[model samples]
Target: MTYLPLPQPRTTPVRVMTIAGSDSGGGAGIQADMRTFALLGVHGLVAVTAVTVQNSMGVKGFHEIPLDVIAGQIDAVASDIGVQAAKTGMLASSAIIDTVAGAWRQQGLAGAVPLVVDPVCASMHGDPLLHPSALNSLKEQLFPLATVVTPNLDEVRLIVDVEVVDDASQRDAARALHALGPQWVLVKGGHLRTSSRAPDLLFDGTEFREFDAPRIDTGHDHGAGDTLAAAVASALAHGYTVPDAVAFGKRWVTECLRAAYPLGQGHGPVSALFRLNE
Candidate 1:
C-alpha cells in the first residue's frame, strides 16, 4: 500500500511580545496577554518586567525585575523568535520603562513592528501599579515610539493631568495623549458611570472615531484593559490596521466581560477562553 504525504503548515504563526508584569493570580499582565494572543491565533512572547503578588481581591505587593534582565528578555525574543508586534503593560518603574525603550530602539523595532502601549498606572482595586516618578519617563521615552497608546479613563487622567468628566473632556484627553507622539490614542471610557454605553474614543491626530458597547454590569472584569491591549497587538500581528485592530480588541473584551465568571472573593477576571466554551 502506498502512503500519502502529510500536508505541511504554510504560514508562520504571528509572533507578538508583551513586556509587562506577571500576575500571580493568572488574570492580567503576562497571563492575560498570552491568553489573548493564543485566542487570536498568534504566538505570544513575554519579557516580564515585574512580578506581582496579586489576587482577585487586590495587589498585595510587587517586585520589579532588574533592568538588565528585562533588556535581555526583549533581546532574546526579538533576535530569535522575532516579534511581529508588541504591547507594554505594568512597567513598574522608570528604570524598566527606560530599559524597554532603549531595547526597542536598539533592536530596530521602532517602525518595523507595531507597539501598543497600555499605560497601566493602577490596578482594578485602585492599587498603584506604576511608580509616580516613572510616569514622565513612560510618556517621554515610550509614548513617542508607540504605534498606539491605550489608556482607560483613570490612566488618561494620570497621563494627561486632566479630569475626563464628560465626552468633551475625553476628546481633549485623547488629543493631548496623541500630542505625546503615539500615532493613535484610544481613550477607554469604561469607568464612565453616567453613560449607559461604554464609549471608547479613538483619535489619530486628524480624525476621531468612537467605539461603543453596552456596559456589562458585572464587577468581574479585572484584566479587561490588559486583554484589550493584547488583543490589539495580536490583531496588528495578524495584519489589521490600527483602527480595525482597536475595534476588534474592543469587541473581544466585551465578549470576555460578558462571559466572566466568579473566581476569588472579590473582583474576578474576564474569561479569555470564552469563545472556546461557546
Candidate 2:
C-alpha cells in the first residue's frame, strides 16, 4: 500500500546582515560574509558599501556606494525584513563609515543588535582596501557601536599601534582596542610569526578570554577574517553570548581554513562549503 505524504511547516532562519563591499572575485568582502552566514544556519542580508574590482591576487580598485543608498539599504532591511545581527567591512571612506554608524543608530541596531566590526583596511597581499583618511573615522565612529570588533594582527597594528610580537602583546593590543568602546575586542594572532600556534585574545572591560583555532597550514586564507566575523554575527543571532559566539566563530573559521583551496593565480578563499554537510 502506498502511504500519502504530509507537508512539513516551512521554517525561517535568523537574519544576519553584512554591510560591506561587493567582491567581484567572489572570495572576500560581502561574498564571504554571506556565504559564512548561510553555512551557519542564518539568513544573509547585505548593504554593500563598495564594488571592488579584484581577484585572489589582490584588490585593484573599488567604488563606494552613495551615502544615502547605503543608509537606505540598512533602513529597508531593518524596517521590513528585519535583522537579528549585523557586521561591517571595507567601508573605504570616512563619509561611508559615518553613514553606516548613523544608520545603525537610526535603525536602533547600534547597541540593541549584535554588530561585528571587521576593521578591514588591506588585503592579505598588502593591497589597500581602505582610504588613508578613513582610519580615524573607523576608530572614532564605528568601534563604539560594535558588540565585538575582530581585528587581525595587521589591523591590530593599524588600530592600536601595538605590534603584537607575542601573546603578552596580544593582550596589550586587546586592552587598547577595548578602550575604543566596543563591548569586546578580539585580537587575532593568525599573522604571528613568533609562534607556530597563533591564538586569539578576547578582552572585555573586566577580564580576558582566549580562543585558538587549529592552525591549518595553507596560504589560501583570503576570506578567513570575514568568515570569522560573519560566523560570530550568525551565532549572536542564534542567541549565543559574546564569548560563546566568538568561540563558535573560531571553530567554524578553522574548518573553513582547513578546506581552503587555490582559485586563481594567487591565494584562494577560505571555504564554508565544508559546513554544508555539517
Candidate 3:
C-alpha cells in the first residue's frame, strides 16, 4: 500500500494554544481565538473546555467536556506538539478549573508558558458563562498561575468586587485585582464611560499603564474579549514581553472592532478579516 507523502517542514516557530469552549455561532470562544492567532501569525492548538450553543441572541445552553478529556487534551498538546503560550476562556465549572490548574502545574507550565487567563464570567448579552461557585477556584487556583488576567468591567466586579466607574476607580479596580496574584491584571474599560476613548488599564502589581483606542461608535463587537486575549497569547508566543504583547493585542483588537459587522437579531462579532487588507 502507498502511504501519503510527508508534509513540508514548518517555518513557523511560534505555537499558541487556546483552552476554551466552542462557540457554535463562531463569534467567540475558540473560533475567535483561532482567528486571532492565525491573523497574528502563530500555529493555533486547542483544548476545548466546553461547547456552547448560542448566537447573537444569547447563550441558550452549553455542555462541558469531561474532566479527564479536558486534562488529556492539554497534556496531549504539551507533551507532543508543545505550545509556547496558552490562554483560557469559558472554563465552565469549579471542577474544570481545578483540573486545568492541576494539569498546568503538573506539566510545569504554570510559570513557564505565558498564560493569558480571560476570566470569562458572562457573555456580551449578559449571560453567565462560568458558574458562581467557580469564581473562587478561578481566583485561587488559576490567577496565581497566570502571566496576565484580562478582565472586562463586568468580570472585574464579579471577581474582585470592585465597580469601575471612572479613571480613578479603574485604577483602584486594577489594584484590587492585582492582590489575587497574577503577574499582571488588565482592567478593560470597554464598557466604562470614563473617557471619550476606550481606555484599558494594565497593572503589574505596582505600576499602572493605560492603553486606549479610538472608540469606534458601534454595537457589533461580540468577539472583542476573546480576540484581545488571543492576540496577547499570540504575541507572547512570538516572544513579546508581557507589556508589549498586551500593547500589540490592544492595537489588533481595535482594528478588529473597527471592522465589526452585523450578524443576527442581537450584537454581532468583531472582524479579523481586516488583516486581509494588510
Could you list the CA RMSD of all candidates, in the order they appear? Answer: 5.0, 4.8, 5.5
The global C-alpha lDDT for each of the candidates, from Candidate 1 onward, is 0.90, 0.88, 0.90
Off by over 4 Å in 3: 1-9
Worst 10 residues of 2 by lDDT: 1-10
Q: What would the C-alpha RMSD of candidate 1 be, to one decimal place?
A: 5.0
| Model 3 Cα lDDT, one tens digit per residue, 122-162 | 99988899999999999999999999999999999999888
TM-score list, all predictions: 0.95, 0.95, 0.95
Q: Model 1: per-residue lDDT, tens digit, 162-262?
A: 78888999999988999999999999999988899999999999999999999998989988999999988888887789998988888889988998888
Judge candidate 1 at residue 97 and give its lDDT.
91
The C-alpha local distance difference test score for the whole of candidate 2 amounts to 0.88
Model 1 segments beyond 4 Å from truth? 1-11
What lDDT does model 1 reach? 0.90
* Model 2, total clashes: 0
Lowest summed lDDT over 10 consecutive residues: which window, candidate 3? 1-10
